[model samples]
Target chain A: MADTDKSPDSSRRSERSRRAILDASLALVGEVGYNKLTIEAIAARAGVGKQTIYRWWPSKAAVLLEASMALSGDAEDEGEWTGFPDTGDIAADLKHVLRLTVDQFNDEKYEAPARALTAAGAIDRELGEKFTRQLLEPALVLYENRLRAAQAAGQIDADIDVRIAVEMIVGPLTHRWLQRTNPLTHDFADTCVDQVLRGIAPR
Target chain B: MADTDKSPDSSRRSERSRRAILDASLALVGEVGYNKLTIEAIAARAGVGKQTIYRWWPSKAAVLLEASMALSGDAEDEGEWTGFPDTGDIAADLKHVLRLTVDQFNDEKYEAPARALTAAGAIDRELGEKFTRQLLEPALVLYENRLRAAQAAGQIDADIDVRIAVEMIVGPLTHRWLQRTNPLTHDFADTCVDQVLRGIAPR
Candidate 1:
């Protein structure tokens, strides 16, 4: 317990504290929401000194951002990160991913924290940019990579902008989820994939 | 000025107060955001009593909702509400609408209040549903109507759900605007329209 910072035991204790802080962040944000979330509260919930949190993360948003990333399997542990699937069938692959998205969006544990972050980001430009860069952008890169692969395979049109193309697949689901305009369903996910891939116009 | 509510002069005065209240609501929301905005502030800014606002609208969200509707030309003045255009060329028409949306989203005056409401809606389920039904749904209906017309003209696939089809056109634009993922531009709008109409697959 008295080991120095450079020692393996010390590092293990630090890692445990980090995990506790992140888990507390997600739980607190889900309960009290991002606006009400405070560093002191997170520290209390994690059973750590407030200084410990400050030493590691700059802000509550930063803590929550990392927590959300970890929840989505986008943690810094590169070994656990799985990129978008590509089975050479772009439409089918997209549907699979989107269906999973639907399930995630519907999951109460994920929804509260995600919605809190999203809501906070909407009004706070700094947090919005940070969230976009730290969390959203990397996830988007996977879609872009998949679309590029599709282009190479002659599945997607060669001229399509993969960046914008990624939005087409993700946007409607987000819009539906955020706006609560309709039920998020597997059928809707499959429809989005079909329409985007085949186009809504008559062939 | 002592006339009753049935009097024309009293009605005109009430109309002026209503306009002032809505205008003040928009201005205050822009300056302070939805959460910080209060009935007292709006009333003070509008030069009316707090009871005046409550007498007309149930809550601040309602006041802001009306202001937003008016800003978007969706006011109860039926003659002023121009439905989505039907040029028989669905792509051209959609691009036209989306380009205007890009402009609206970019406008600072519109951006502040709209962002406030959107942020509030994200956290507050009741407000979110009210905003959707009161402000957003009507606008979505316009898109649906246009898509239905295209379907009738055989410009769109007959089997496609017009409701879902409209999302493909509007979703990306909204996602870019809200998430600030990329520039909302006429070119992006046209690309969304073209891609949705033509499908992303090789023709």
Candidate 2:
């Protein structure tokens, strides 16, 4: 949503090279994990110079973040979703997004590399904070927007804190993925969505 | 709450040793991390024999898990909640628990070991699951019981799934702690409880 004016030709060419870099990053990271991945290795596999890789992105973390965003299609797909779904029915909208999320979690290519970045972030405070700003926070905005819309629509109860409400939907999926306690599936997503819309108290 | 059985003589002796082991395990793990922390190191540090360490724990990860839990005080406090507060108000009950959680997260002793175990858990699935069952899951069960009781007391909207709802509360805090995006404070905990209650819509 931020950049909408890149010319098609330039964009397409950039996309091609970007895809190559991402593919290289993913394969290398998957094979050796992040600590051992090198710019030289990325360039060799990407068929671009170390300069090319660094010119577009500053560090391995940057490249990997973009590469991850681009490759998993989580970034691309979620990038489009931007904030939250706005399909009128708040519950249905949340479920729809979460279901798509479940599919992305199932992607094998995304899983290993994704896990590597997340684990690294936990230890590396700088990298983790940057990721939140560049990656996680943008996605959170989508939730913020949707929650606001829901409030305006009177679907959500009055006096709800938009930030906290957003977490209700986001928290469970993340918990499942980070912990790997259970499968992140459509059914589970639906259950989470349903649970949040209404309270757990007996009516 | 389970086998932390109390006694005048044996129990106190056991508790003291358990504390020593947990303290040793936590310090050693923080010093060396999960990959390198060994039974020998932990036992040596605790001034107890390696067999004494093994008599209680089967592996380094288990020792670390229990150590981290014990360090957090969550292990001892599990069933001690006596269920969520019921001052005829569900939100208040939640806020009370969350406030205590904030205090726990802020404790310096818990922070290093918790971070260490959590980081290791991310990469080691079996240990991660074990950590969940022994540490995270039991704590989560406390929330579940609270939600169920809230349902019976007619505080929440009967239809909500307590499991999912509880995750919403837990997920954000865990995500923040593990990722270190922001501080976990009593105010934030209160916000989480309040927001989930009214829902996240602009009122």
Candidate 3:
């Protein structure tokens, strides 16, 4: 394509336009919400042509997801996105990751975009699946690996399905975040860890 | 108000108008989605005057909530809205209720409106809080009571907070439903109950 003209100046300009578009998308979605937000508005706000947005992102949802990821700086570097940590203690590791999640949810930059993305996911199934696969599932696999280590150490039952078990760890935290039912905190995260470790009921 | 004329004919007409308005709201929300839905369109489709809608419900979100509740038939009869059943087995009772939830999530009538409502809730905090208070909290209380019974029966630890423990039971089910990550099923609900009962790892 003519746009693929390989030149240092062109590459720098491309990067600048991309950043502008993402920034504009995030700001507009926060102000007007995802449903009313339009490609034209994003282009105008970004000081780029409408064609620039259309060329890079297929939909507003696409722009929002990329912008969210960029703003959070979590998935920007694929190499740095190295799953959850394993400090040898399953409970400690899980708590550590959950606390980070709580922090992310609490951050103002991430909150509005994340909320918009979640609402978009609920209404638009195809976009929902794409982002979930692109973003959520990879993180879940990390939990699965951590649980596997615990099973091998005999801290957990070997027979338990780690995939399902992982949900128990993450579900409550995400539920509270999405529903706004309660204040998410490190204390809440620690509670989830402790409860899962010994079970909610008595042995 | 002038419409408060207490006559059988007027009351019958009022009931007809209410039903029509609700039906129109649900159908329109499903077709055009919550963002595009308006009182004008709802009135036009319901074949009722716009004043008929404004006289009863304050906004589209209010109308949608009432219509959704009516469609689900869960909160229709206050007296019949008994809490979760107690079959003497805590696990069995929880599983039964969750399976019914799975069924509701699967139903077409519930699915579309519910999707719209959740998206609405995410963007509209005022509406979200209102519906959560009026709808979700009541059901959660039922779970709270059930867990307390389990605690009383010595099935659960007396010290375990029923409020948090209840989230462990319902969270995964809701997380899955909201994300559309998996098909919500009786089997999935049963797995959650079984996993929670015994804990994910060995005791």
Question: How should the candidates be ordered by TM-score, best one leading?
Answer: 1, 3, 2
* lDDT at A80, model 3: 34
Candidate 2, which segments miss by more than 4 Å at Cα? A1-21, A28-58, A72-85, A199-203, B1-18, B39-44, B47-56, B72-88, B197-203
Error of 2 at B35 (Å): 3.1
Candidate with maximal DockQ: 1
Listed in order, the DockQ scores are 0.62, 0.36, 0.54
**What's the lDDT for residue B199 in model 3?**
50
| lDDT preference between candidates 1 and 3, better one | 1
Clashing pairs in 2: A83-A142, A84-A142, A199-B157, A201-B156, A201-B158
Shift in Å, residue A108, candidate 1:
1.6
Docking class of 1: medium
Model 1 lDDT tens row, B1-203: 23356778879889899889989999999888888999999999999999889988888988998888777764235342356778787777888788877877888878889888988887889999999888889889988888887777777677787787788888888788888888999999998888787763234
Better of 1 and 2 by TM-score: 1
Answer with 1 or 3, whichever has the higher TM-score: 1
Candidate 1: misplaced stretches above 4 Å?
A1-4, A74-81, A200-203, B1-4, B74-81, B200-203
lDDT of 2 by residue, A1-203 (tens): 12355999868866777788889998888777666789899999988778777768888998898887766454556563454567798888888888877876787676777776777777677888887777777777887788788878777766666666666677778887878767788988887777667532112
TM-score: model 3 vs. ground truth = 0.90
Score candidate 1 by DockQ: 0.62
lDDT string, candidate 3, A1-203, tens digits: 23686699998898899999999888888778877899999999999999988888888878887887676464435343445787788888888888878877897667777788778788888888877877678778888888888888888876676777778778888778777788999999887777776652323
TM-score of chain B of each: 0.89, 0.81, 0.89
